[model samples]
Target: MPVRVVDSSAPSQVSGANPSHTSPPACTLLSVGQAFSGTQNVSSLQKDEAWRVNVRIQGCDLDHGYLCGTMEALNVPMADTPWVIQVVTFWEGEIVDMKNYTFFTGKWEATVGKPFPLMVVLSIVNRSEVDTRHWTKFPSFSPLLSQVEVDGGRSLDLSNYPYIFMRWKEQYFVNVGTDCGLTIAGFYYVCFSCSDGSINGFYYDPNSSPFQKLELKITNEGRSGFSFSSYELQ
Candidate 1:
């Protein structure tokens, strides 16, 4: 999987900001959607440049049946540059929700020490089938550990470190369990399990390096221990 960029000249539109609202007016099935702004390619720029991404979310209105918002991205200087950022909403070190705005930096900015920008417009409508009951169909997996074992038998303590998210596909990543539990660090190593082989999601911490290529799978044994392997980006 590869990192994706949101064009900044225009607004990126995503749907379903808060799906758990139970009010009749705010009742809508949540689905992940994205729209890119009209930003240009920053791959040819020098290391002294980067993009500035801004975000704002209008609180969900129970009376109105609508959720709307906007995000902005601008190319700026690297000296005081706002590098790649992950806007995460959490409480007391436990992550509630997270989103990544890479703005297409993986294509060229990955090695440039600078990242691009993205602007997003979030407009969620009451379109999906209305279900009063909150959906809990996905199985849960926990990856909030201070230490994890890589393929080399070495242990890595990721407490207080930037999160390393594994890309599962274009604009999507393997889910790192959140809201189910709380941890001392805001971030943890990427690890999880799924018997049905159905769960995949996204996570990003701006402090970490640009997105990298990785290979992830479940062994045929099904009950094997958790392990992670990192590959050199080509």
Candidate 2:
């Protein structure tokens, strides 16, 4: 995903602090989003630096329909520089299967005058149906995730993490989502099962991955374990 530089005049805002801290930690869906602004006395050319930024994406400003990202740094020095402060805000309750997938993002801050200014960019990973137009579907598998775990541990929360799904385009496929490493590189190892039997799984994510294809070695064994293996871009 590519980040965008917003107008310094306006920035995004954050609302709805997660009291329960239940929002997925991956997207900071429940963390505080804050903005910063201060005039720096540029006595001499300063070296590159970083500043913590806040982006609040709402209906007013949206790139696609939602924003799912983490803190990123702008190369420009946060010291002795004039910058417009902004915060991109989004609804704190966006946690559902398909609806929570929409993200709207905008607003940014820019520092004036520098050898090579680098503004912290507001990057995006669009989950809108339109962006997934070219995705291919795979054979449907009813994986009974009774013994499956996510990343690690025994908890499987499909809302924030990737999971198995059945029947999308008359073919069965895995819903990797904008998450589950859509931009990740190499193969995806998926493990799941159905009531009829159990199966070992793997996925080969081609470039521009999405609606990823699934490969399952269907069998009636290995019913008490879960494992995840893959290589993702850093």
Candidate 3:
């Protein structure tokens, strides 16, 4: 048989979980030279909902040196905006490539980073803005981080500030929020503005139990002043 549907009970090689859901995930393994041309309903963990995405694998074969196929995403959870489906190709438990699709219902050309005969795991991840567990770490320091100076007024070490997991610039981790030093805060950046070469914004004060305001200003010369003010939630 050119193709066989691997059981969902097979041992998992992938790591990481949604954290909010405890239900075991369902997966399918499609090997190179597979003759599959039908659809399979794969359950996905999105917003703690049992969302099913009908995936169709067609004409799967080797193209030039990479695995190529026509993959379609159907019957996805309906939304006001299109859902972003992430296609992840894993080779021997290591991710080789990834792609995204803004899909309500659509088909896309699937290509694996490696060539044929080498079986890979094709995973369909439904990305949601509310799911922070799957959020990726930043490759570098946030742009806002560079403009601010910390206590003792020393410049922040970019090396210690990498990999702050974030979904958007609006919400992120800050390595240094106070004199406490090297503390990770779940605070977020709000109301960022740059006018006449000056920048200002508010960050949740990690030093405070409730919402406190941390004021920062960046001048044209790249010098910034930091101050703290208290406020109560309405």
* Model 1: per-residue Cα lDDT over 107-209, one tens digit each: 2111232222123321111111110001111122123211111111012222222322221111211122232121112111122222222112222223222
Compare the candidates by lDDT and give the number of the best one: 2
**TM-score on alpha carbons, each prediction:** 0.19, 0.19, 0.18
Residue 99, model 1, lDDT: 24
Given candidate 2, what's the lDDT at residue 151? 13
lDDT of 2 by residue, 156-223 (tens): 33333433221111011122122211122222222222232222222222232233323223222222
Q: Which 10 consecutive residues of model 2 have the lowest summed lDDT?
A: 165-174
lDDT digits (tens) for residues 110-221 of candidate 3? 1223211113322212222111111111212235222221111022222222121111011111221222111222222222121211112122222422222222232122
Clashing pairs in 3: none
lDDT to native, each model: 0.21, 0.22, 0.20
Least well predicted 10-residue stretch by lDDT in candidate 1 = 127-136
Once fitted onto the true fold, the runs of candidate 1 whose alpha carbons sit more than 4 angstroms away are 1-46, 60-68, 75-143, 146-234
TM-score rank, highest first? 2, 1, 3
Choose 1 or 3, whichever is better by lDDT. 1
